[model samples]
Target chain A: MVPLLEFRNVAVDAAGSEPIEGVSFAIAAGENAVFFGVEGSGLKTVAPLVLGLEEPSGGDVLHRGGTIRGLDYLERLRYKNAIGYLHGDYGLISSLTVEQNISLRLEYYSEYLPEEITAITERLMAELRIIDKRTARPVQLTRSEIFRTAYARAVVHDPELLIIEFAFVDQSPLNIRSFMDVLKARGADPAKSVIFMTYEPQKFVDFADTFIMLYNGRIVFSGSRQDFFDSDNPYLVQYRSTSLRGPMAIS
Target chain B: MMDDERKTTPSGGSVAAYVGAPLLRVWRGTVDFAAYVVSIVLSFRSLRFIRLRSISATILTQTRFTGIDALPFVIVIAVLVGGVVIIQGMTNLPRFGIEGYFSNLMVIIIARELGPLVTALIVITRSGTAIATEIATQKWSREILALEIAGIDPRLYIVIPRIVAFSLSIFSLIIFFDTAAFLGGYLISLATLYMPVGAFFGNLSQAFSMKDLLATIVKSMMFGVLIPLISYYYGMMPRSKSEIPIYVSRAVSRTLFTIIVLNVLVSALLYFSWLE
Candidate 1:
């Protein structure tokens, strides 16, 4: 089957001196992938491109095997409706409470009645163990509650491809696996998958079925899970075995 | 190296640089403000069910925050000002033995100028700065981007409601200030002197004409328009937390400058129209 999302040699001149240049990768259907690198890796800019929030300077994106560019209003709306984006900070609205944040997506997008939206939102929140925090705003919640709220909001929308942008970079492997487990239980069949971006890949090493590494404005490596760990590519070795994981002078 | 760089500028070049930099910044800022106004206008569309509800809800929410919650402050200020005006009018004009002209001066000063200017100043210091700080906070937290990604239009949800609320709030607060001050002045006259309430109100009515009303309303409305627009513009302009205070200070200065200029224009127009 064709990949769920694909970027063909994409180039984006968004950030500082080094632009993402001629990078290519594809996420096959029902496969969880991680775009990993150390600090300032340009991976953050890469995720927004998939959501069609930013257009690449060169090359193209094929979403569900069709061109993402030049779609009409309704088509673009439909395309966006199919995605569930979880921002790095959870991206929950500060003014809206947790329940309001989750139900907002449902009521706004779908024609669910107020009662039904409330019921659905409550159910999802309860499932995520965030029902007690439903009335809390983003500012009032703890770090863990914020993550659970974001997860509830995204999953409640029931999107085809869930895009997580670096929310779990510092999470323990056990914590990361638990989130993966929740995702798996949400859709047991291989149809549900994730595209997570992070600087810390060791936490996701066991959970990620594939690795796509960005470095120096290029996709230095993109291959199978074992292919990445097994490869002796100097960049992979640097990433995998670096004691400079904390911080270092970049010149 | 720093000393060498400082020495590179000649006296004339330094002067030119000083003048040119501020002028260039002002020009760029004017252009940016114009673009922001156009963006706000373009954001408006024929209302659909959801957007209409959202906009309505936001406007009401903001109206409560800006107008109703502002009641106590506006009243307190108005009362204190009312007492001060009466005391000054009663005592200060006696050197000319023109105590009868006190009511006329009070009417002109309070009704035509002080009412709206004081109200605008209050809003600028309070809500205007608050709007700028809140926008900066939102931008810092990336909540604006979050709204965009969620398919919500920030202009309609965030900017328009604020504009509407500030406009209505300023209008209502001006009316509140004028009424409370006038009544407060009238009450002081009742207690301190033997003048009848009717005579005191009659003097006030004679001095406070339709032109004064028109001028005050026009100035208040113009102030309302400037406060939110300038606040939103400056609030969204900051690149970092360090720049937040700079942007907010600039916004406050711009708001005051705009309100003063608008007050002069409206007064001139009202006077010219009366002459015509």
Candidate 2:
């Protein structure tokens, strides 16, 4: 079967920074890929590229063996609707309450009755533990609450693919684990693929089947979970090290 | 000799730059605005894809904000303006023994001119700035991107509802302004000029024409479309927080200028019998 998403020798050029050169990856349906890198390693570009928000400077971003570059209006809309994105900033509409924000996509696209939309939205909000804050605006919600609300909005439509920017950097490991558990429970579809972009690899080690490490806009390592931990590549070693000093330059 | 040559060359370049830059910007802006209008028009095809419930909810919310909330202010302005115009017409027209023409003056100023223009000004100052700032904030927060990611077209979800609301609100507000202004004029005449109610009603009915009504409708609708479209265009241009205020200001100023120009163009066309 064709992979659900693929990046074939993708190179993205950024102004005032190094180009993300020669990046290649493929993710089959049901497979979860985790991308980790230090700040400014071009990991942030991956989400936008896949979302078709930004075109790669070179190479193709394919969705199911087809190029997503030049599709017409309706085709593009269909492609966008098939995927869910949890932005790093949460991307909640400030004017709307949490409930409105969560139900917005479903109500807009689905043929579901109003009652059915509400029921589905309420279910997701409850599962995400944001039901209590359903009436509150984004300004009133805490950081984690915002994340949960955004996550609910993303998955409310049961998208075929979910691309998440792991924003639990300051949270504890237990909180991260619990969030991961919720994600797994909600997004357990065998045909649904996920791409997790994070700086903290250990927290998602158990969740992702494939690991890809990026350094200075290039893939330093891409392999199975075991191979990722076992590799002694200088960049991987540096990443694993707690010290600031390493073969990889911090700046 | 070399210094003089350099000075002359630089001066010539500066002259060309000063003249060429603004011309280029105007050309680019016109092209961009045309493209934006086309995209919005094209997005109408996808309206069926959007849920009717969603579209109606958005339009209702926008109308409430743009029209309902603005009622008190619009009434106040209309009343005051109408009283002033009537006071002036009464004070001067009777001196020339043409006071019978007071109703014509009222129809020309209140119905045809002030109704649409004042309402348009009110909307530009209120809803227009709000739309610009709101869209800028949404863009800044990536809410627009979120909508796109959810496969909800911002044009359908955000722009169309707003355009519809702005148009409807301005159209309704113009009617309200005209009614309130006439009422204010009558009250002013009753209190100060002792003009009989029957006489006022007779004069107004005789002065009013289909042409006046047509002018008011055409101007109000034109202003309505231009205000939101211009504001949204500017709102979508800013990429950063610091640029929000600047773009909002530009949106307001440009919208104000466009409304004035369109108002004149419409009036001139009507005057020249080019439009009915």
Candidate 3:
């Protein structure tokens, strides 16, 4: 069976910086892949490529064995609708209230009645504990509220593939655990595939089935969780010890 | 290295380069804007697929902001202009032994020229800058990407509503401005010049032709389209937060320039039959 998502020798060029070169990976259905990279490691670029927001400068990004680079307008829309993306910057529309932002997709595309959309939105808002801030604009919300709101919007439709970038980096341990629990509950569906691009690998070690580490735009390691823990890769060693001295330069 | 480069560079080449670069950029910008307009036109086909409820809500909000909220200011400008035109015409036309054409002068100045132009100026100052800044902010915040992720086309949701609202709002505002100007002109003349209300209205009725009304409509519609298109084009060009203000300033300047040009073009076309 084809993997749910695949990156085939994908090389993305960044202006005035190192380019992500000769990268290859895949995630099968129901598998969880966590990507950990230092800041400026070009990990953030992967999300836009997968979301079709940016095309790869070389190679291809395949969604279920089909190239996603140049799908026509309707095909692109359909592809996007199947994936749930939580952007690193918390991409919430400032003009819209939290409730409006959450229900935007449903109100626009879903065949559900208005009452049903409201009900679903309410449930998600309540789950994320942002029900009280439903009527507030994004500018009025705290950073945590913004993250929760973005998270709720991303998962509101229960998409097949969920790609979350740089989420929960600054959240309390309790909040991260709670969000992980929510992710765990969602993962029980068996067909859900998740790719998390983050800076903190240790925080998600328990949740990830596969761990991929990048240094200076190249994958330093990719393996199962058990192998990841057992390996003596210098980057892994550096990460585990939280040491300042390592092969991977801090800057 | 700097001295070597400077030694190799010719003064004439530098002058040509300095002049050619901006001209090339302007040419490129014109081509890009033309392409953007074409894309907007093409995206209209997808309007049928978009939800009408969402479109209507956006249009309503835009109309309230652009048209309804502008009423008091528009009224003030109209009254002042109307009174001044009447006062000037009364003082001057009689010297030419053409005092009977006061109403014609009013129609020519207010309805044919100032109504649409003033309304457009107001809109460009008020709504055009707001739309550009809002879209630029949304882009800087990654909200446009968010819409794409959610499978909603920004063209349909953002651009179309603003286009429809600006057009409708400008059209209505021009009509309101003309009416208020005529009424204000008549009242000012009645109080100061002692002109009979019947004669004032009768002359105006004769002077106000269907062509004047057509001119106002045409100008408003054209201004409406130009403002939003220019604003959105600039708004979507910025790549960073610091660039938002620069892009917005460009949007305002471009919208103002385009509206004035379009107004003049429409007026000349109607009056001189230049296209014919």
TM-score of chain B of each: 0.87, 0.92, 0.90
Worst ten in a row by lDDT for model 3 chain A: A171-180
For each candidate in the order shown, give its overall lDDT on alpha carbons. Answer: 0.77, 0.86, 0.85
True contacts kept of 2: 0.79
**How well is each residue in B26-124 modelled by candidate 3, as lDDT tens digits?**
999999999988988898776666777666778999999999999889988888888888888888899999887788888888999999989999998
Q: Please write out the lDDT profile of model 2 over residues B1-276, one tens digit for every residue.
A: 699897767677798998999999999999999999999889888877878777787789889989999989999999999989988898899899998788998998888888999999999999999999999999988899899888888877887888789888999999999999989767975667778778887889899988878888788778778888898899999978999999999999999998988898888988675453
Clashes of 3: 0
RMSD list, candidates in order: 4.3, 2.4, 3.3
Runs in model 2 deviating more than 4 A are A14-18, A170-178, A186-188, B1-13, B273-276
- TM-score per candidate, chains pooled: 0.86, 0.94, 0.93
Candidate 2, lDDT over the whole model: 0.86
The candidate that wins on TM-score is 2
Interface RMSD per candidate (angstroms): 2.9, 1.2, 1.4
The C-alpha stretches of model 1 lying farther than 4 A from their native spots are A1-3, A15-18, A65-78, A105-111, A170-180, A186-192, A205-208, A226-234, A242-251, B1-17, B46-50, B55-57, B90-105, B189-194, B205-217, B274-276
DockQ of each: 0.30, 0.75, 0.64
* lDDT at residue B203 of model 1 (Cα atoms): 87
Using TM-score as the measure, name the better of candidate 2 and candidate 3.
2
Using alpha carbons, what is the TM-score of model 3? Answer: 0.93
